[model samples]
Target: MASTLRFSVTFLTLLFSLWVVEVHTSRKLISIKEEEDQTISHLLKDGEFDDPSLYMFFRINDLKYDLKSGSKLPIFFNKDDPQKLPPLITRQEADLIPFTTSKLDFLLSHFSISKDSPQGKAMKETLERCNYKPMEGQLKFCGTSLESMLDLVKETIGSNADLKVMTTKVTVPTQNTVSYALHNYTFVEAPKELFGVKMLGCHRMPYPYAVYYCHGHKSGSRVFEVNLVSDNGRQRVVGPAVCHMDTSMWNTDHVAFKVLKIEPGTAPVCHFFPLDNIVWLTK
Candidate 1:
């Protein structure tokens, strides 16, 4: 009887060990794929967005994140390449630590948003696909992820909570290069009391736009944008496709928000927002 009992115990122990090993192996494999995809996406930020392998903007129309209340993303840059923009005045910088899934869940809760929500889930996945914070010591996100980063000089002199991104990716005409500029990404903060909790929300801006602009490309029937976050989502100017830059807030006829025009003229235009058309809501 004793020998039989010992044999049964040993058999169960072996089964449990195999199960543990299998589980660990499965997770490690998943993480490996995650790392590979994340790195490729980063490299692709400097490549053509129309590449068949990229899927960032390919599902733009299907991308339904909760932009109604505003952004829930960790504070990052408006561009992958800040050099493409005009030189900064001071060029502040800082090191950002990665926010783990648990951390994201905690922070998002303050906004009355759930990390498990449909949009929340999408953001989580997006964050995984990109390196939100730096690893080791080097800053890989400096010029690509964000144009500039604010120093964490915790001076309690301003608002208790604040986050803002006023820049966006754009294609420079004539030169035929991809770049970014301010698009009035406004952030409005209440007294931190929404649903009995603090919240900072987006206002008058599209959500993390980087892919999909339609203009006459010198190459191929279709021109791809570099650093386009998504290949599925795109914006095209209908009608005459006349473009220009107008900084005046009064100019509603302007094609883009807070941008310099590639071509200047008073040409009739019909803009299509198949992908990025988010606007600020006050109601």
Candidate 2:
């Protein structure tokens, strides 16, 4: 009787162990699915261009905090005239008027006169004497011109003690083979510790025979797709089997490879062949 009891207990323990493993596996699969969903959400929210073929574009760069806050001057210009312009105040500007009321109100009240009025003509003459160009066509905010905004902001911020702003220029290749600006903006603080803040407007492309490094926590499946499809002939090696090999074999050979804790999702996989075998495949 005692022997029979022992056998039953052993069988129950084995069954319990199997159940635990199965549950753990299922939970891992759920977690992976959640992560994939979050990635897709981010891409949808931040991507502005409508190129369906593009996998992803860099996020828009904006002025950083270090830069002198551009005179958030509220200004307007005549749509038809193109030159004669005036400033329109926003709610934020109105609230701020109390703090800098004397200077702001003086500028605004003087700007109220029409260009054809005597006082307006006198004011225009005075501005011209002071090197202020009567902005024709529109009464727009006449702080610094947009063309020089980036540079002016950089210089202004760099002058201050607390802030340091630098600019990096990256050239991106267009489909027509011409290179165009990818990012240009003043940054307050570095976005990433290693990589300074950037304003990007280019798409990421995959290169042939190159392995992309990915972190263990959130795998870059979309990035992998971009890399795989970059070469027209290399598209076939990107599905389930290849993804597995990329995560396992190819990663091991490259110095960039880092071990990832994969749950129930597919592993990025790669296969490497000897030089002779590679020649055979190419032939």
Candidate 3:
């Protein structure tokens, strides 16, 4: 009887120790997340983007963040705009209509585009980029449709994941093109750390229809959600920003370096995703 009682006590002690260790780990993760949040908040508030091109980026309507629970974020342009969004097709459809060199002439004719035109060049470039091999530590895929984009996201973060999609939302119309100097902005929602969050960033590619180039990094990067009120209370933006922790692989003459006045790898480079870009995160 005494031996059994002792064994029970020992088992209870081991379980208690495990529980304590789990609690400690949880607290540590929370602390790290808090620290990351503070860091991102500081960068958003203090980082300078004096160049008009850089400053006006926040005004772009397509890059706004949408955190609201929904079935999924649509790939269309802002409803306020008159031009209707291009029809979104599926991967199978895209493959059949394949935008390839062999069909370049056919594509241009169908889209009413000239081979020598800028849009034509962009289309060709997009095709090339989509086919190009991804760099080390990067996973890339060009999504020709909403379903295709979601497929990539699911592949990256798992199909059962609780997913969140963010795009830039424009709050002020006139202020969209205005400079940052003319604005006084505040963070509507404090920056949140996305540690251990799986992410897929989708960049809108120029096409007759919607084409998204989605990519994810392996490491040395962080993502955050930011809300900004700019243009002296006129322009407000809810957006997602990514901070690249390692810029060592980046070109020395990268624009971020010129704007931030820091060389590659010297410091972390963070920038707001362009209007029309999407950042998918798993909750």
lDDT string, candidate 3, 121-172, tens digits? 9888888888877777877888887666777777876665356666665455
RMSD of 3: 16.8
Off by over 4 Å in 2: 1-39, 45-165, 172-191, 194-283
Better of 2 and 3 by TM-score: 3
Query: Where does candidate 1 stray beyond 4 Å?
Result: 1-98, 131-283
* Candidates ranked by TM-score: 3, 1, 2
Give all candidates' CA lDDT scores: 0.24, 0.23, 0.58
TM-score for each of the candidates? 0.20, 0.17, 0.63
Q: Give per-residue CA lDDT, model 1, range 108-146, as digits (tens).
A: 664355666775775455444343443222122221112
Task: Output the worst ten-in-a-row residue range by lDDT, candidate 2.
Answer: 274-283
The alpha-carbon lDDT assigned to residue 153 of candidate 1 equals 12
lDDT measured at residue 229 in model 3 versus the true structure, 0 to 100: 67
